[model samples]
Target: MEFRAKTVAESRVETVHIIRPTDLNDAGRLFGGVLMQWIDEVAALVAKRHSQMNVTTASVDNLRFLQGAFQRDVIVIIGRVTHVGNTSMEVKVETYVEHTNGKRDLINRAFLTEIGLGDDNRPAILPRLILETEEDRKEWERAEMRRNLRAKQRKEGFHFYGE
Candidate 1:
């Protein structure tokens, strides 16, 4: 299958949000579910930008909450495509708290597997990911390992990935 190539920065996405009272849970901290929704959107957008097609979140793995966010905190979410297989791509989404001094602390991290949707809602062919920098290369390698682990969990049932 013919596939185009896209750089990691080509589809990179960054979004900022302010944690409001509504975003908090009964404990008065930012709700985990709300943050997950935000990151999920970022992942989908990254995949859509890279593939130039509609995308769906097939799986969310390695979701980690490192810290808690409070109301009135500025939240910054960044998403980037780490690796691409035939029809799917792994997107790493990071959530951080931006301080007044411009410092950012990582609050959460997740890797989402997004699959492009073609005509008739079938899995779509996607462009390849070009690893331009050492960081990008390392992220690709980590994603490969994650995919392999996931494949092992599924007993290698997938045909287009983790082989």
Candidate 2:
């Protein structure tokens, strides 16, 4: 049986600010950690919608800082679940800077895999994923690759910074 799949944009919960003061480095740039925090929050929301259970970050893959966000600029975090696994969902989040003139630029892109936890504090199964569009197909393929990579790394006994 096939279950319905939800898009990343559909599960976005909120848009937080990329305040100038958050740039602790004083390099006149928004900090990388700040952007990650925003992405985590948004990805959590997407995971909750898909799993209907408490979720926690399993791993963050391919978080590339493509551009920088200015102090007063607004970073819009858009996120959605691209694939649902037996006990985890992969969420793709894109952050963009909105200029005063209404121009938008893609600042960063990342993928997060979060596992749904049951009341027993163990991973739980989620609804099956359904791919609807070409973009979704591409994302699903990418997600599969990421999953395989993570598994291989785990078997090799490597410790990552964040999981």
Best by lDDT: 1
Q: Model 2, range 1-163, lDDT digits (tens) per residue?
A: 2335555455556575756784645687888887898899999988888777789998888899997777678878888788777888889898888888978899899999899888888988777666767987988888889888888997898768754
Model 1 poorest 10 in a row by lDDT: 154-163
What is the Cα-based lDDT of residue 20 in candidate 1? 100
Reference-based lDDT, each prediction: 0.94, 0.80
Give candidate 2's root-mean-square deviation (CA, Å): 3.0
lDDT of 1 by residue, 1-163 (tens): 4547999999999999999999999999999999999999999999999998889998899899999999999999999999999899999999999999999999999999999988768898899889999999999999999988987877856544443
The model with the greatest TM-score is 1
Candidate 1: clashing pairs of residues: none
Local error of candidate 2 at 27, Å?
Answer: 0.7
Error of 1 at 25 (Å): 0.2
- Each candidate's clash count: 0, 2
TM-scores of the models, in the given order?
0.93, 0.85
